[model samples]
Target: MTTRGPLLAFLLSLVVGLCLTVPAGAVQPDEVLDDPALEGRARALSAGLRCLVCQNQSIDDSDAPLAKDLRVLVRERLKAGDSDEEIIDFVVSRYGEFVLLKPRLLPQTWALWFATPLVLLVALGVILFSYRRRKALAKSPKPLTANEKRRLKRLVNED
Candidate 1:
């Protein structure tokens, strides 16, 4: 109805959109360490661990109860003087390696990591072979027999 009304509506929508995009850390205040270094390490590890309930989201980004439990477990392990690797290994053992956002390179995961590239290469080879074969066929002209030429002449005359 008025410029002021439309402008106010636009401003309200902009504020709501900005609020939604603001990154909210899922870690609770009580779980934070006094030592900044340890807290930093805990945060890094949390970022790599996948939330089981929210498969694609990291434990650091997820709001699930299981994610909170994992965050607490990681902090506890850090306080107990566990190395980052040990804490990760403990979680992996408990939940299986699927909990890791980036899986470790090992015999078990070789196919998982390499299968897509292998399949892509195979598909590329097939496409190239098909293209080359089609090109070759096109380049090599087929000799028209006498009957075909006669048929062509008759068809042209009929038209």
Candidate 2:
């Protein structure tokens, strides 16, 4: 009964902790578009942008002031009748391509993108060839005379 009480209390606390919602105040109401479709587009654009301050998070998810400013800028661009691509281009021009979560597939970007997989394939082929060669060497019977075997066995027994 005593153990059960502590366990129940812990479980209750865990449940309460899980239910608590952390408020994200990154995007203010004024930044949102009045049109629902435009607002959705703004959100989509924001999500695609990487937060410069919080490098790992999207601008949509980051609470950094810079991220908020970027979000507001996106909304403002959308309100100014800028197309999604135009808004993206505006931001990309301001910041580098690193600002985009998914970068454009340009020639330079393709080189960076394809380099890893090509390198991995070359490494894998080398490793597999080495493994097969080692196995073949291990399996191939070594030539040994009866005299040599006898001498080897005697040496082992002496040791």
**Most accurate candidate by lDDT:** 1
Top candidate (TM-score): 1
Runs in model 2 deviating more than 4 A are 1-25, 142-159
Model 2, 15-112: lDDT tens digits are 88876655344677777778999989988999999999988778988889999999999988898999999999999999989899988888868977
Worst 10 residues of 2 by lDDT: 18-27
- For model 1, how many clashes? 0
Root-mean-square deviation per candidate: 4.0, 4.6
Compared with the true structure, all predictions reach lDDT values of 0.94, 0.89
lDDT of 1 by residue, 15-123 (tens): 9999888766888888889999999999999999999999988998889999999999999999999999999999999999899999999999999899999999999
Error (Å) of candidate 1 at residue 65 is 0.8
